[model samples]
Target: MKKLFMPYRGAALQLKNHVVMAPMTRSRAIGNVPNELMAIYYKQRSGAGLIITEGTSPSPEGLGYPRIPGIFTDAQIEGWKGVTSSVHEGGSKIFLQLMHTGRIAHSSNLPEGHQVVGFSAVKAAGEIYTDNGMLEYSAPVALDEAGIARIIDDHVKAAENAIAAGFDGVELHGAHGYLLEQSLNPYVNNREDNYGGSIENRRRMAMEIVQKITASIGADKVGLRISPFLTSNDMPSYEEAAVHETYVQLAREVNRLGIAYLHISNNPGIPEKTHQDIREAFANTIIYCNGFTAETAEEKLQDGSADLVAFGRSFLANPDFMERIEKNSPLNELDYNTLYSPGEKGYTDYPELNYISSITS
Candidate 1:
């Protein structure tokens, strides 16, 4: 059997195949809670060995996007239970990705009485979509020491909630200029305190969150996603050397903690040396995601570069993604429209190959 289709055995993860469904926010969670529609959507695409859920806020303050789900509330947890149960019934493990959007948000998206907060007061230079339409990024309230502590606690509680909701584990959204990434970027984090300044100081928040979460839940049930050198979400470019060192150090620290996996959001901008350095530093399952076809993903697995490969758009468009790959069938093109719009038109309406074949016959 091909490596991509082969079962994987690693730290607390046993799966049907090596393919992973990368987390992509679909904004279908009406009222900031998961529902039956979301459960059906995940169950349809449960061919992957593991499914990391879309960015779910760990707290009310972290709901930075319109219609994104949260796991911090009782109703949210109950809603996610249906989704997790459906995925498990299809024989796939699922992890809830805890994301705090931080400064990459507008106030209108957040719940009443909850304001945008981040490592620093600096505002990201981009507009985020809200019910009121495109609005400038909200100026973040720089987290004092107490605020930082509370955020960390929120992440720990969310992880616990995920397990209660029937998730196999939890993945921390430490990338894409979210709250965790905000602290890692020196340009955004201008504090002189211990949580900012030098590389160690800047990375303190992430380390603290990871350490606490791993302690709260076993290390083997936790994963983190990172996108180094990604300038998205209005993240300013910093010294390249510093960027390389920051992640390498983080990899080493997490490795010491014996976490489940490190998900690297593949970017063309990252140097080969950076990849090699991260591969060497972190001695566990490393998932490489973004723009990988099945052929290229197999090549990555065979070359020993990535233990598992994650697909975002492929799974988004094709519910039976594994069946299509095995049969060498053409994939359905993704509809750019309704990517985040409410309802099931472009979301769950994508046809499976079997359904298409029956219709054509």
Candidate 2:
């Protein structure tokens, strides 16, 4: 077998290669429903061995940004069926990344003006761009035991919906200061209950969600995305000992559950020893994203530091990214203004290999 095209295991995945398409939040869905164009966008790049979708909300109240898609409603499910069907036809496997915005949400984007919910009432220090405009985030309702149970049920339903929509599996988005990450981070979760006292408890919410989701789907169909010390748009890095230790515990506990893979950060120089140490705790496939070059990814793969490398910005600009990597071709520069806009003008309008004339030519 070719070295770069080698197959690998992700706790359960029998995949074609180690190159993964990272989960990107493209604000293109309509009413949290995937459109035909969206399906085409994904199908265009099915050359990657694995494709993890954009962050999809598990519930309406959990929506954090305008036009971000979901996996909850009937329309959304049907819409995603189109996406999965198209991607599969293109000969690629994909995992639906189930995400919850938590306190990162804005009332304007929610249907009933629901207040954002978190591990505590602490409002993350950031702004959320909603349909109305940019809004200052408010303190989230501290999830009581009942609320925690409710959230778990929601995740279960979301996972079921994802599978029903024909996705290979569901990956809990536990990174970038989202809902699951909020419950794990001490800086956001300032509670005294069993859900927040120590590192183990703080990580309890994530574990419970995982347990519920796996129960709804099978263990082989369950995976999780986590950024050890990644700060969000509003949350600064509190990547201290308390935070790092919590994740080490998270990896230890979640690993036994037999998740597909543990998605992590790519900034080795920044996270340094702490990050590498955390990666050592989990004996599963580690997928790393953010600023990864082909050569660097190869080194990590050969060194056994990461089993898979997820490409972010590179994939956006180069739809033929996987082929380009294999053939070492030049990449196209992405147009920034069209990134978040509606329609194919910027999203799917980019040309393929022979379509666009090189700007430098």
Candidate 3:
């Protein structure tokens, strides 16, 4: 139980404790650029041992949601510099999560001349919120061989950009039915080439991206996030055996590469035995996230099931989350309405434990 508060070292980054702040999309970046407001929000939550930022696009075409941040342009790089510096000054390490929306994107959300592309021409089933209102997703252009090569190059460049922006590492968003996940889905990827036949073929693109990112920046500075059989974002559900086979193969490959860590988006609902299998297969640092409380996290740590635990909504609403756990203090309830809205109302407005007396009795 005491282990959750102890310092731990991974392949490249050192953390003060085991509580990671999971990556979540907060559509606060106006004009697709990071700003001082975003920096302030991250700085306020620096109590986290590590912060995996909201999904940030690796390129212009990767932009899916309105106002989501990007890491490609010079201005965007400069903007993230402010964020990384702020988080560092407060004594926390941060990793940028690179996400490509694939067929899940709305054309209006992207820049001029940019079109949505995916593993195949299938349209993801869902609506994305825009300035006007909810808009249906459009079918994407399927990538050819040259297109696949370009995507790999884009990922490598984004990884380098992340380092330049003062991020300690970069996480490839391989989950949530995004570009990488779409390729992994048998139902979505109907290609005949080397990239889309068997399980190994389907996993090719994801593996290639991981390899490229690792080559560009040492494996120690890269992490991959995967959510097996996640249904969100129009991702199809696979049989339990298929899910296990696909993820385990991925786990074994990444483990061989000796990447920094594997961040598993494990809801408590996932079978415990399956989680253990992947854990043993990787045999490296694992950060598990999904509705974990202080007690439950401590239990996982004590049982050696997880090396670190991630807090999402808890840390989102409580800037002093670690301190709150230490003191057993009550947490502020999150206002869901303001989560994706612009400005600081539901973001930096959450108070620290010490600030309560100044705000009220």
Candidate 4:
């Protein structure tokens, strides 16, 4: 009864192994299009089993990181084609994460002549990165029902674009207080309309996007990422329940449609009870990320708490992460200084499995 490299078999798709590289935004793209260098970076890690590409805007309004890629434009799609080709040649599957930043944005990063939009007109707390250092976020314009419908359409178009770009599927960026999460957060969303007021209503918009995208491209090609529960003790109780209920309801709805996966990010500082809820709520493949060491990943996998583990910072520093973990090898500590810095020095220059082999050769 020993399975060192168990395959990840879901309802419709199958990954060669359980090691999935979590999407991390590295500001290295050009004009919001991933470059040839970015392609090589991901291709080098084809050993990850499954690689979730960096958060890509589903529309101009979804812009988060200044240099991050998008799935909207032909140029963007063509840019991703190179990346997909590279990853495929290395023999791996990848998903493009459709990220809509919502209230978590500044005017500088928006499309030319574009304004930020959100579920509510309220402003997000703290500073957002801008060309002129970090600046306070301005109050975003609340989306009318028409605007909400348009965004859903944007996600659908992006899903189609993802498929054309050679992505295996698209993962909706619904967590981390992004646009979808903003709708679910009571603190952020104070609307009295059908998209708000109650937990069911709060979860409505995200569900609609899921239904639209999964329909546009089969549900089996779609995945959702959420960090419904936060480690911040500062979050209100109502917000926590809304997050919890949203995840459960979204999972049930999408699970009914046979979606590929649901990724839940658990901040290490949070209480343990949330794990019990995630275990009971998600019936399909549930991927757990955030502070998951190798031993923890194995433990949770064996216990059926999660189907796969998403390694973020570790994968950044160690491109051969899957092979390393498979062989119980040590990892190179990540260089935080280079983490979103403007260069390939730390991004693509990280050592690969062959490099490590040569060291031992």
CA lDDT of every candidate: 0.95, 0.81, 0.89, 0.81
Q: What is the TM-score of each candidate against the true structure?
A: 0.99, 0.93, 0.97, 0.93
> All candidates: CA RMSD in angstroms?
0.8, 2.3, 1.3, 2.3
What digit string (tens of lDDT, one per residue) describes model 4 on residues 160-265?
9999999999999877778888887787789999998887888888888888888789988999987766623122335555455666676677777778888888
Candidate 1, position 18, lDDT: 95
Native-to-model Cα distance after best TM-score fit, residue 300 in candidate 1, in Å: 0.3
Question: Which is better, 2 or 3, measured by TM-score?
Answer: 3
Top model number, TM-score: 1
Write model 1 residue lDDT over 1-361, tens digit each, in one string: 8998999997668999999999999999999999999999999999999999999999999999999999999999999999999999999999999999999988999999999998899988878988788899999998999999999999999999999999999999999999999999999999999999999999998999999999999999999999999999988989999999999999999999999999999999999999999999999899999999999999999999999999999999999999999999999999988888999999999999889989999
Q: For residues 1-361, what per-residue lDDT tens digits would candidate 3 score against the true structure?
A: 3777888786666898888999988898988999999999999889888999999998898897889999999999999999999999999999999998888899998888999999999998879887778999977999998998898888899999999999999998998889999998988999999999788999999899899889888998888998885778898887778878888899999999888889888854466667878888886789888878899989988888888888899988998898899888999999998888999999989878788977787
lDDT of 4 at 248: 67
Summed over model 4, clashes come to 0
Which residue ranges in model 1 land beyond 4 Å of their true spot? Answer: none
**Which runs in model 4 stand beyond 4 Å of their true positions?**
1-4, 231-243, 269-274, 356-361
- In model 2, the Cα lDDT at residue 148 comes to 83
Error of 2 at 64 (Å): 1.3
